[model samples]
Target: MTKTVLVTGGNRGIGLAIAKGLIANDRRVIIGARDLASGMEAAETIGAEAVELDVSDRQSIQRCAEYIGPVDILVNNAGVLYDRRVLQNPGDFDVSMATMVHGPFYLIQQFEDHMRKNNFGRIVNMSSEWGSFSEGLLGPNAYGIAKAALNAMTKALSAQLPNNVKINSACPGWVRTGMGGFTAPRSPEEGADTPIWLATLPDDGPTGGFFRDREPLGW
Candidate 1:
């Protein structure tokens, strides 16, 4: 059976690239974007379906889960970089956490049981090197902090999930996306490679780990 893969923020950037890569590999890809029109357009272009998903909102996430039903693979690629400094814009910090950390947490809780029952699941959380303590945990203030928390959650959740259900965090290095800026060294396709690899890991694949370019990275 073809697995249904949901890639959040799939309207553009690395998410869109990931969706395309999955589709090319014969997986059923669903583009989850906050904007229905753009999402639909991207889905149509990629020959996939689109679902409105605003990862910052719990109600939106719940509604999306209900609409899409069970997901075989999940790529938590939706994220945000707040405008102001952590102290300058505390609200933005909340926004950052809501999207990067809390949203993925809710999705995991909502679908983990289903995965457990099926005895198969693959989850890839889009993390950043900025989240790596060994690398200095440096980036936009709120973005770095929120992703560190996300990395922690990935490890915590993996411990409880079934052996067949693999969950791992991936850091797609700076890529040429709207978020990554034009000068980034990598392209979206290059960035998607690692996450796609994690999403399609074999039964013996590693779990509860952080990886970049398919290699383990410091947490």
Candidate 2:
């Protein structure tokens, strides 16, 4: 059976790569983006449906959920990175957190019931290695903090999910994207591998884990 998959921020970057990967596997994919034109164009390219979704906006998320309906796989790949330091301007921190953490958290809560009822689901939260407090790397304060919170949210949701449902976080590493900039080592295709792996995991796969390149990574 073709699984229903939804990838947020699918118009570009890692999200777009993941969408293409799923499409190649013949999954029923939907590309969600903040821009309708870009989203539709991406969807057309990947043979997927397009839905308008701005992770920071609750109304947009609601509309996308209503349009896509229940999906077998949900990829929370939308994120924002603030280049400023914590002391630079604390207000920007809230904005980053709202998009990176709160947005995905609320969407997970909203779609969780559908997963529960279906008794089968896969949720892959896009996280970052910079979020690893254990690693002691703290450049982008807002981005790091938000991704750490996102990882925690993934763990919490995994615990609440039924045996048939699985939720995990994937760290795409330093990929060359608009957010990652041109200096990053990995390509979007390489960055997307871990997310696609987690999304298409078997029923027996691990949950509540943080991974990169299909291998568990330090939180």
Candidate 3:
């Protein structure tokens, strides 16, 4: 049976690459985007389905979860970068946390019980080295802070989930996405590699860990 995989922010960039790779691998893929038209366009191009999901909105996240029911896997890839004035503007920090931290948290809560009942599931949080204390939480504004919270959640949630269910954080290095800019050294496909790997891990695969390029990374 084919597993169903939903990737947030999958209309473009590394998320799109991950969705395409999953489709190619015989998984039932769904691309989530803030814009329905673009999401559908990307889904049609990639032979997958599309769902409207604005990770920054609580209502949107809840509605999206209801609309998509149970997914075998989830890729929490949606994110945004606020201006350098995060401290100067409270809304920037709020939006950052709402999108990256709270949104994924609610999505996971909505589906984790289903996964536990099925005794099989995989969750990949599209985290970054910026979230790492080792990396100095270096991402500008609240980006790193939000992702660090995400990484912490991944570990916390993993403890509550069953053995067959796996949840891990992945840092897709600077890829040539809009966020990564044109001069980035990596391609979206290259960035998607480790994420796709984590999404399809065997039962014995590591859980509650941070990784990049399929190797362990410190948080």
Q: Give the best candidate by lDDT.
A: 1
**Each prediction's TM-score against the native?**
0.98, 0.95, 0.98
Model 1 TM-score? 0.98
Q: How accurate is candidate 1 locally (lDDT)?
A: 0.93
- Regions of candidate 2 where Cα sits further than 4 Å from its true position: 137-139
Where is the poorest 10-residue window by lDDT in model 2? 132-141
How many steric clashes between backbone atoms does each model show? 0, 0, 0
Task: Name the lDDT value of residue 106 in candidate 1.
Answer: 90
Score each candidate by Cα lDDT: 0.93, 0.87, 0.92
Off by over 4 Å in 1: none
Per residue, candidate 3 scores C-alpha lDDT tens digits across 72-161 of: 899999999875778788888898899899989988887888888888999999999988988888888789889999999999998988
lDDT of 3: 0.92
Residues 25-60, model 2: lDDT tens digits: 889999989998999998898788989899888888
Residue 120 alpha-carbon offset, candidate 1, angstroms:
0.4
lDDT of 3 at 65: 84
> Which sequence of candidate numbers ranks them by lDDT, best first?
1, 3, 2
Q: Which residue pairs show backbone clashes in model 3?
A: none
